[model samples]
Target chain A: MISVLRRELLAFFTSAAGYVLMAVFPVAMGLLALFVFPAVLERGASWFHTKELTMRSFFLAFPWVAAAVMPAIAMRSWAEEYRGNTFQLLLTLPAPSWRLVAGKYLASVAVLCLMLLTTGVFPVMIAANGGWEGGPIFGGYLGCLLLGSGYLAIGMFASSLTSNQLGAYMAALLACGTLTALGSFAGLAGSSGALSSMVRFMAAGDHFNLLAAGYLKLETVTFFISMAAFFLMLTALGVEGRRYR
Target chain B: MLNVEAISRSYGRFLALNGLSFSIGKGAILGFVGPNGAGKTTAMSIITGLLAADSGAVHLGDDEVHATPSLVKSRIGFLPETPPLYTAMEVSEYLRFCGEARGMDRQQLGERLENVLANTGLSARRNMPISTLSRGYRQRAGLAQALLHDPDLLVLDEPTSGLDPAQILDMHELLRGLAAQGKIVIFSTHILSEVEAIASHILIINHGRCLAFGERSALLGADGKERGLTDLFISLVKKRNP
Candidate 1:
């Protein structure tokens, strides 16, 4: 497992796709948080009343950003191997299939962590502004992590569906998009009561919203964990299907 | 060293392999020759445990290939036609990963990497990224990775398919050298000359079945009784189709 992880890390760093993703994603977020959001805040947007408000905005915006960026990083995880014909080589190895999938998934999470770390300036700015609530800030960060995990799982499932990286990227975008859109007033969850609850349960926003509000509900955490596990199992089953079918 | 019994594989309505069975003795160099869509790759894939057989069993030594894939896979090395390689990684890095994937420890991996680099004549390009290497070098790197764990059996699918004549000869010689070192080498090729150059045993497959399997000399028939290997291959294919 360590060997696969090491190799995946090397590949992620060496390829141009990896470098572009690592460089572009964080810079884009930094520009958004430091410049764009502040401009919006300065435009008499009084709803963002306190440091908690600013953190909530940041947390709320993160899922959309990740919807695009995570796919760029994770879509190639397995698809590239299939395109390059390396999947056969990988499968023939003595290691189990789960190890390979897990290793690649972790490598992608590491890259996402690096991207999140780059946005550390936002938290610092919030702290500098004073009146920041420690609970919500910590909760918001936790929410982001969980959201990232769920996105990574969806991206992995997309990767397993096809050998084409572009196809994987598009599929991940669509799937994550639907999940993200479900949280909005215009989306299915907002207009319907029962669907709102179900969508709230299914969408990353439901858990993230609680975390952003400084309420870490056990049910919400369980929701994200279950979703992540479900997609990961699907990815594994997709991989296993290749050998059997 | 390797045994396949009544192995069959299918994809939807298409049959890839139909009750194929064969075995290779220790240290033997067997050439799997067939035209396109002849189940050569499907058979090799099943043997190496990359693809599962629908209804059959493969035994590497005493272990069942599918039932105990890790055990069988640990003792086998395989290179597909496209030479599965991570082009982003350096030659040495990829080889080290391949070694570890085969259950090698750090010390064993380091030693084996050095040995395979020398064996595949890739010592000079060890640190070069695979994407930067020439086609011939890429194939050599693929061969090096497969042989890195020093497996008892090697399954190569069209290893020299796209190489120039000079590189093809080099690859042939490399397989011969591995066989001489007591490794069971089974390579697939459409080129009859390549088979004649290195293989002691020949298995001619058509459609999805093995049409003939025996010593190269015997399969070619008695002197003047049959034509060259290519002619034999053509006639066998025709006979099967007819």
Candidate 2:
């Protein structure tokens, strides 16, 4: 598994894909935080429009941003293996299926962390302004990591389903979009019924919303962890499924 | 010894490998020949544990491949038709990755890496990225990875496809050397003469059924005269198709 992780990281760095991805992720997120979201929400002249110095606007745009970028990060994970005929080599190696899945998943998450790390300027800016609290800021960054992990896991599973990278990206985008959109459904978050609560629990964005708001609930953390694990298992099963069929 | 026992696989309504069974002992080189889409790749995939046989199992000695894949896989090395090269990585880096992924210790991997690079005649191109390699070198890189682990069994599909005659001869010599070292070699090729040159045993299949499998001399010289594989192959295939 460590070898796989190292190779994956090396593959990313050695290819044009990694540098292009790094530039695109932060730039896309920066654009949204600096221009798109602030303008759409009519906050102020910029993200700093209000007197409050928080990353609230940034976290707010995270699910959408992650939905777009994490898939791009993961679209090539398995699709390239299938297209290049490398999966035949990989699957035949002595490692177990879970190890390969985890290795690839963690590599994407590592890339995600680096991508998120580049946005350190946002938090530093929030702190440099002298009115920022560490709690919500920390929670929001944690939320972004967790939410991005979930998005990437699903994206990897989508990639395993097809040899076409574009098709993988679109499938992942649609899946993540639906899960993120579920949070905005009428009365879903506000309702108290068991069915609505269940639906609310299924919305990945709702869990991210809690962490981004500095709630730090255990259930929310579990939701994100389980979401990542569940999709990772699905990706493993999809890869194994090819062996028999 | 490797034993593929009554293995069968199907894709929806079409049968791919239908109760295929074959075995080879240590130091034997078995040539696998069939027409295109004749389940050569599928059978190779099943033998390597990359694909599962629906109703049968491949055994390496006492352990079943499907039952203990991690254990069985460590003893088998497979090279598919395309070579499975990661074009972005250097030749040495890719081989190291393959070695480590197979769970070789650091010292063993380092030693084996040098040996395989030298053996495949890829020492000069060790630093070159696979994407920059010619078709023959890429195939050599693929064979290098399979040999990296020093497995007891080596299964290659179309091991010399797209190579020039000189490279093909080089590949035959490499396979002969591995077999001399007591490794079981099973390779598929479209070239009947290549099989006649290197294989001690030969298995011919058509439509996923074994038509003939025996020692090369016995199968070819059965009637007190040497018979060409091309004539035998054409007659056998025509019998099945017609």
Candidate 3:
């Protein structure tokens, strides 16, 4: 497992894709947070609350950002291995499929952590702004990672389904996009009715917001963990399936 | 020592391997010669415990590989036809990863790293990305990865498939040296001269069946038969399928 992680890290960093992703993700976020979001929000009276310099805007925006970035991080995980014919070598190793998947998953999470680190400036700017309390800031960071993990898991699973990186990326984007879109529709379903409640319960945004609120509910944590585990298991099965055929 | 008994596998309606069986002691090279789709790769995959046979048993000395694959896999090094080289990784880094994947401790890896690199003549190119290496070097790097953990059995599928004559000769010498160290080496190849050069024993297979299995002398048939390998293979395969 450690070997897989080390190799994954080495592979990611050495390639042009990893650098481009690491560089592009933050820069795009900076442009949005620093310029576009602030500008657009200020122009719309209905978006007044969104224009406020609070952590909610940043937290709210991340799921959308991660919808793109996480897939980029994970698209090549298994897809490239299959295309290169290295999957046979990997499967033949003494370690089981789960461990390999776990290692690769963790490696992506490590990069996500690094990408998160680059966003530290946002929290610091929030801190420097004085009016906002610290509670939602911590929660927002937690939500971002938890939400990113779910995206990573889905992307990893998607990668395992095909040998084409573009196909994997599209699959992940579709899955994550649906999850993101569902959250907004649930929000529109309006806060009180059972129909609204059920959609809210299923949507990732509700859990992400719960974490971002700083309450740290048991169910919220369980949802993210379950999402990660479910897809990781699927990824393992996808890998193991190769030997049978 | 290795024993492959009654291994069979099917792919939908196609039977990839049909009750194929062979065995070899240590310090021997088993050359599997066959036509395309003859199940040579399937047999090697089963022997290495990478793919389970629908019905069969594999023994590495005393332990049954089917029942305890992890142990058996640790003892075996398999290089598939494409070599499984990660183009993004440098030779040394990739070799280290293979060593670790085989469960080699840090100290064990350190001790063997230098030798494995040198054995495959990849020491100088250790720092270069595998993509930058020539096809010959890439193949050597693949061989280097397999040799890292120092497994008892080395299974290679078409190890010399794409090599030029010089590269092929280099591979023959490498296989001979590993066999000299008493590693059970089994390689599948289409080239009869490769089998003629390195393998002391040969198994000629076709349509997922073993047409013949014996030492080089025995494969040449009884006293004074002295047929060339091409002639021998043609006659045996023709006689069996016809």
All-Cα superposition RMSD per candidate: 2.6, 1.7, 2.5
Best by DockQ: 2
Docking class of 3: high
Order of the predicted models by lDDT, top scorer first? 2, 3, 1
- Tens-place lDDT per residue, model 2, B7-124, is 8888888898888888889899999999998899999998999988889889999999989999989999898999999998999989999998999999999999999999888999
Model 3 chain B: lowest-lDDT 10 consecutive positions: B219-228
- Backbone clashes for every candidate come to 0, 0, 0
In candidate 3, what are the lDDT values of residues B38-127, reduced to their tens digit? 999889988887787899899999999878878788888888888899887778888888888888888999889999888878889999
DockQ of each: 0.83, 0.88, 0.80
Two-way lDDT contest, 2 vs 3, winner: 2
Candidate 1 residues A1-245, lDDT tens each?
77777777777887787778767776777656545665575663433433243665576667888788778778888898888899998888887787778878887777777777877777787678775688888888788888888899899999998999899999999888777766664463466688666766666766677887899889878877887889888888888778986
Selected candidate, larger DockQ, 1 vs 2 = 2
Q: Which ten residues in a row have the lowest lDDT in candidate 1 chain A?
A: A44-53
**What does the lDDT read for residue A97 in candidate 2?**
85
Off by over 4 Å in 1: A34-54, A185-196, B222-227
Candidate that would win on TM-score? 2
TM-score of 1: 0.92
Candidates 1 and 3, the one with greater TM-score: 3
Q: All candidates' lDDT scores?
A: 0.83, 0.89, 0.86
